[model samples]
Target: MKFLFKTDYEDDIRLFPHSGYLWTYGTLLVLIAAAPFVLSSYLISQLVFVSIYAIVGVALLILTGFTGQASLGHAAFLAIGAYTTAYLQQFGVPFPVYFLTAGLLTGIIGAIVGFPALRLHGIYLVIATISFALIVEEILARWESVTHGNEGLRVKTIQMLGTTVPRDSAGFYYLCMGVLIVVILGAINLLRSPTGRAFVAIRDSETAAKSMGINVSLYKVKSFAISAAITGLAGCLFAHKLTFISPEMFTLQLSIEFIMVILIGGAFSLHGAVLGAIFIVMVDPFLTFLKDDIPGAIANFSMLMGAGAERAAAIEKSTAAVASANGLKGAIYGFLIMAFILFEPLGLYGRWLKIKLFFQLFPLYKRATFKRQKIYVKSERNR
Candidate 1:
């Protein structure tokens, strides 16, 4: 509902486009700060999970959404971080040292992978990344001396400035929240910088970005490193939260969930990452309701209506069977992803924008306000 008429070049570079953003985001921060105090301990842990996944979601957006480079092997980078931290812990390495090492190591590996991957695009690039993930999975399984093979490595509590912090404690919740805040701020600043602009350019068109004097190859590699580094930090938190590390933990499905986080959250938005994380974290409970609670509710209703016990029981059994069928959860998630791709490509955040704009414009709004345009040429910018 708000409009800004830019009169100066500085206006475009402002951190918040309008006063509304400042007020709304400020309110959000206050709520997040009070979450630990007001929410249950288990829910606080869920918040920690959301924070960690949000980090990974933002990283994926940096590479796939902004840089125009697609990746399916992000789980490998995540594994590298977890294993690096676990390995370093054996030597009693400090938190800062191990954390930095995890990020740097993953970044270097990502850079290595990005160079060869630059030659590939679209589905080929996806395949290449998935191949990388498979390779990392194999190495983790084979490298028994370092990764402990199939046996999981237990992660101890966080060692912060010499204090041991439990993962579920309020202090740890604060730590995770703090890290998420920093990462979001850093991402916001990055997107505002020239480097981030270059990423957007490359994503729109590598040939055009190169024509414009941007080092496409260099920026692409940098995007990979930056994205990988962010995911690495998430891995550290994820490992600690799970209290275990194994090759099976960082599977292709896990990497797909990271993509799901970005897709459902809004691939091109920083806020999307956080929203997607929240959605992903809450999905387990939702799936449980669908699988277990729905059947029970139906049974109760049927019995209340004086239906025979046999019929009610049969109905419940059939409903439970269908809901609990193997791959139903994945199928539902995949269907939703497909639906979004087909009907709401811009994602949840995009849908929110459209709805808000419709209400603001009332009868004046047109269907074309948020319509998607087909690109005839990949080298041309639609943004």
Candidate 2:
């Protein structure tokens, strides 16, 4: 049983509140540092992608989870960053300058979108974001001169200060990991600051927050800008990672996947972003494997139905259905979102908390210790 007894106010707010956390984080860092040497090239590449998604996930968490704003158009910000980097790189701009430029430009766009839509909440805001995403996708497709339309754009190797990092190189992977670490630390610090508190305050109760003199509208716009900036940085890295990108890549499905990361992992917690990224990245291979195995399973089942022309025709239809099911990735995401929302609102992080508490309490743990409670009230105002 571990106890984190706070000695002072500083201890309560410290990033790592206990000595156990220090050792655990230190060990995790050491393992990450050694991963390039110990892991296969494929695994290393996957981790690179995980790092990129983790950055985006954290950005969404800040906006949706902390600020209580919803955006179904985050892919638009990503598309902006990617295209910005691709366009600027072609003009001989260095990686750092173009990268930061992408974030800045995307942040400005986010603020523009947020200014008018921030006043709207719930489904109205979601619809607005969805419209924004569709508009951006159309722009990307129609702007053939700049974005090359559906032909897509090829990205060159990223060049830092006198150093070039190729997409497949270990240096590129380390660069991504380094950026992820920095973003995680920065997010943690931001969440502990006054600005982060204001975000949470707005999320909890905008009316109460306004009563306390918090500028609700300004902070909402700021939240959008900051979230877009972070996601845009991830997009810059994503472009370099893939070495090629098309407008089709930043679809509504991609935005949904971003939301899934925080939803399944735990929206209100920073670790949830990383956990969700890992789950999303790792699950892709499993899904692919299932896609492959399903056809064989279906064929075997068809054989068991006995040999006949009618059976053969039915088997063929089943085979086609199974093959088409590969495109059900969006359906899978929707199912996962629904399941998490209904059964585990706090997400995987919440489950982790419960397990940790169980272990801490040991034999004294009660079955109802972590059970959720429901409260209902009848209102005369409704009548």
Candidate 3:
């Protein structure tokens, strides 16, 4: 009898209010589209990274978030796609054909790797995928003639229909935005389909899903292929945009970053991916600045270092730049993962949806209970 008060079927069915979703997404889309006009060049550049992460986050959402498959080798797929772009350019292949070939090739590799998932789960599966990523890195670093060893390869300027796209920040931002919109819409449509249902079912319970006549193995591999294909496309864009490639760029860190994007974003939610990407990318620089300012501002730091003010300033700047380039991002990423798990498991989008729904259903509600929950524990509690 106590359990009845704790659970509500009607509430479960009404978890995502229709009006709220519409208003929230509609407003978000408008803001994203208008960002270029109001944002700084640096911000636009950051937004380009956000867009790239959005695409990768969506891919991670499909495999790990939607299908509940743990993967730590996503960077390998990105590497495959990037290397393919470089390889095709070397052979003078057209961009369109090259991208298609890269996606297909990466998908094939993803499917093959996913085969092991048929018998593995949890940490075992994660280890296998991570091993696969390490192996890919080893190959990229060792294959001298093809991969150019540690020297890395330079990417050419993007040419579409004989016109070279501008290599500046604004052009790249717009290009990334276009790709992001298309990918997001495509992801939403896919998740609304039968295949998407199968993936979700498998995520919930592979045994039950298999019992219901879904081929678990086939769907798992198929989901991985789709996820990898999307990541591959993002990689192609990333490689072309940077006009450079190296094995170091597609390391295990890259894979961890993709995972962080989705985890920080709500799992199994499309908007969460975009929201997570935006928040994470924007916060990265701020964290780096904080790291630099703290050390420089400390009184003990000035006393301990006999170095002159000029040297100190230079050291501070260099350290700040290094933090900005790498260390700060990882620390913040880890912090975000932990924080989201503790406070907002559904991520920023989930919180936004809650606010939208609350306003839409305000004044009439008798109980203090929210129509849509944004808090971390709400998912399990709602269930």
Candidate 4:
């Protein structure tokens, strides 16, 4: 009997060991670490942008997705982070210190914001958060002395350990990717911990969670702080990447875009954060190419139909911006969200999981019988 127990324990340990996950994770880390040398400059830059967005998206997901706290003012945190990093750069602070400070400052702000959630519910809290965002914009735009009042602030090349990192695309990409990996892994760990579960419980039912002796208020606030911190890190990266900071960069549109990413990627899933970021950020370039390369009616008709070179040039000039502003990103995001809601509400990862399950039992994968419907059925019925 003892041998049987030991054998089962060994099997479980082998099958679901920490080393296995670590090995896979470490391998990924190595790839990301070495990606800069092999990847082209353009692709590297794209990946860097992806990393920045992923950081912010993950931050938002932790708060809204896992903690069930709706935050519309997340850009406020990003603003805080950007300004902080810019200030530090202007003042000649060390890179590591500046980065950490950015996160810490935003985290403090987020904790303060979370306090209202203790007393408010649903849209009430959402409104307050939105108001906070608007207030931040006002500050950024009006604080001419500090924020430069829409003139924007310049960010010098980020220096690490007294050595200036190259501002070239590849170096920047490597740096962003490295930061992204750290933040992502940290988020994953947080979600796997007791604190994360507490957030989830509070999100699902604060009253029930409280009844079960969970410190709902504390967790809610903590999640907000953590979420803000993650975004702040992203903001720091953004400032460094762009070498500029402006109120316009952290607009309400950006806040909405972040939320859209969360919705499209699947709320509360880390993988969703990544997938959403890639989708939102990549859509612009992809569509731009489709416009130029495809040579369809939309492109040629507009080009040829213009009254003359003056009008034609003007029309051609507007094409890029018009294509950009036509709300295709929003439309695609809305469609994706609706599709996920209707067909795969659990998001892309959920669909992938179902497909994997289908393949795992391929020969046994039969049509759903009235007695045994595996894909979709009432939870009560399944039991």
Candidate 5:
């Protein structure tokens, strides 16, 4: 219901459109600052996961959401960041230098991939990214000298300045939260710049963007590089958070989860990335709890269905089979993605906007106020 009337050009482009936004954001910042002391260690760890995913989610949003370019292999960039951090630490590289280096290396690799992928579109681009992910995984597994292969690599203690922050400590949590805030602010600023507008123009219509004199190819590569750099920076934090990582941890499924975060939360908006990260992190424990209880629940149901010894044995076997279906998490993610695409394409953020608008308009709001509209151009049909 809040409204802001712009009186000058500065008001139109200001980061905080009104006093309400300023106060709201300030309150959120205060809450984040106090979270470490108020929340338990387990909850803080979960928040760290949220922070890590939020960073990566913002990166994906830039490329896939803002630029209309799909990358199914972003997890590879994360792995590159993690491994780079790990290897650099062995040579006694300072934390800041190694962390920045990870991002730089991954950005270079992403631009390299983007260069060859400029000719592809839609599913073809997706396939190329997926192939890139697979190739990276294979290389990580085979290159034992550097990556340590399937045996995995343990991260050394994280040292910044003269202080060492343990993974389980609140200092580490603050580090992650601080980095996430910086990245979010940077993204907000970037999207307000001319470069960000060009990316959006390419996404909406490449031909039109080209007609406007935008360097579509160069912008696409730049988007990839920037996205990869942010994602890679996130991976550096992720490596320290877990203190151990292997090729398996950066699988295609992980990449899909990153995509799912943005898709479910809302792709076009930066807030969507944060919301998606929170949803994913909060839902994870519930899924784990369900995984633990499902077999017992199935067994109980089977017992209720029959009472014979043979029936009991059959029920036990069925329970075991059902219990072993850890793939249920992946299935849930896939289902959510399909549901969002078909029924609620704009995602959680879009739904929230509708609700807010409906309340703001109250009695004047029509049922069709938020309905989707189709725009059909006769010229395109004729062609």
Candidate 6:
């Protein structure tokens, strides 16, 4: 077991707690830098997706994790950022200008959304956000003049430093990786600052935060703006990656997946955001495997059980039917979300801490060190 005896105030907010963090984070950075050269193009593209989603996860982390605000319509912010980028591209704006503008616009919108959320909490907040998302979707569909309706907008290659950069090129991948790094660094600094600490206080107990003279409403709005800004930046890259933009792409389902990313990856940690992104991006491939292989396997199993040919065929057909349902994907996501809430409330990041502790403590470890208290309270309001 390693122990650190803090001797200075800087120790409390230092970026690297110890040398171990430097080694681990350094290795991770090195790998990210080398990935483009070693990985296949398809996998590289997936990494791009992961980076973008992870950015949004961090945004949600700021609002939902650190500040205890609930939003179910973050996809609206994403769509705004994406469409903003698409719209600006046609005007010949440089990448930096439009990119920052996308985030700024999204942040302003998020702050506006936060105003309505002030009186809401729990499920009500969720519903309000969902309504906002539906409104954005409808606007996107009806405002044919600018959005081009459901026909979508084509995103040409990005021009950086007066050079055309294709989506698959290493330049774009590095750009995303670089952005993720900057966002992570910025979030770390923010968490160590007064604003970040205020957010945490409000999350833990709004009433108590109010007692401390913290402006709960203002902080909540700030949190939303900051979170939305980060997500908007991610949207810029997302639009570029797909080379297309449409209202249908940023649906409620996508917003739910963002929630899933934070929940499953570790709601409280930046590391969780990256892990959640990987899991979310890979879900499609996993579902594809189920769709393509599971039915055939079921048929073979029925044959092994000595079922008649027609019965085996029927069994396979029914199994395929279940797998083919449009709702199956959503159902699986829902189940995973529920399971994580029930079994691992701390998420993948929490699980990681537990495992690391076990290794560190070895035979001296106790299960209760990471155990949850089965306590329930009947409270009608935030603590």
Writing each residue's lDDT as its tens digit, candidate 1 over 240-332 gives 888899999899999999999999888899989888899888987788789979998999899999999999999899999988888887987
Structure candidate 5, residue pairs in collision:
none
Q: In model 5, what lDDT does residue 341 have?
A: 83
Error of 1 at 25 (Å): 1.3
Mind giving the per-residue lDDT tens digits that candidate 2 earns over 1-383? Answer: 76677778788789887678899999999999899899998889999999999999999999999999999999999999999999999999988899889999999999999898776887789999999999999999999999999999999998787888888778998889888899889888998898999999999988899999999999999999999998899999999999999999999989988998998898899989998889888777767766667666666667777767577667766765765575676677778889988988888888898888889888887867756677586663542
CA lDDT, candidate 2, residue 311 = 73
Q: Put the candidates in lDDT order, highest first.
A: 6, 5, 1, 2, 3, 4
Point out the worst 10-residue segment of candidate 5 by lDDT: 374-383
Error (Å) of candidate 4 at residue 92 is 1.0
Model 3, CA-based lDDT? 0.80
TM-score of 1: 0.95
- What's the distance in Å from true for residue 287, model 1? 1.7
RMSD of each: 2.6, 3.6, 7.3, 6.6, 3.5, 2.3
Q: Name the weakest run of 10 consecutive residues (lDDT summed) in model 1.
A: 374-383
Q: Give TM-scores for every candidate, taking all chains together and pairing residue i with residue i.
A: 0.95, 0.89, 0.80, 0.81, 0.90, 0.93
Candidate 3 lDDT by residue in tens digits, 189-288: 7876789889999999887998999999999999999999988888888887678888988888889888878877777688889878877787767775
Candidate 2 weakest lDDT stretch, 10 residues: 374-383
- For model 6, residues 116-136, the per-residue Cα lDDT tens digits are 789888888899999999999
Number of backbone collisions per candidate, in order?
Answer: 0, 0, 0, 0, 0, 0
Candidate 2 Cα outliers beyond 4 Å, as residue runs: 292-324, 367-369, 372-383
- Highest TM-score scorer: 1
Candidate 1 residue spans exceeding 4 A from truth:
376-383
Whole-model lDDT values for every prediction: 0.89, 0.88, 0.80, 0.79, 0.90, 0.92
Native-vs-model 5 lDDT?
0.90
Task: Give the number of the best model, judged by lDDT.
Answer: 6
What TM value does model 3 have? Answer: 0.80
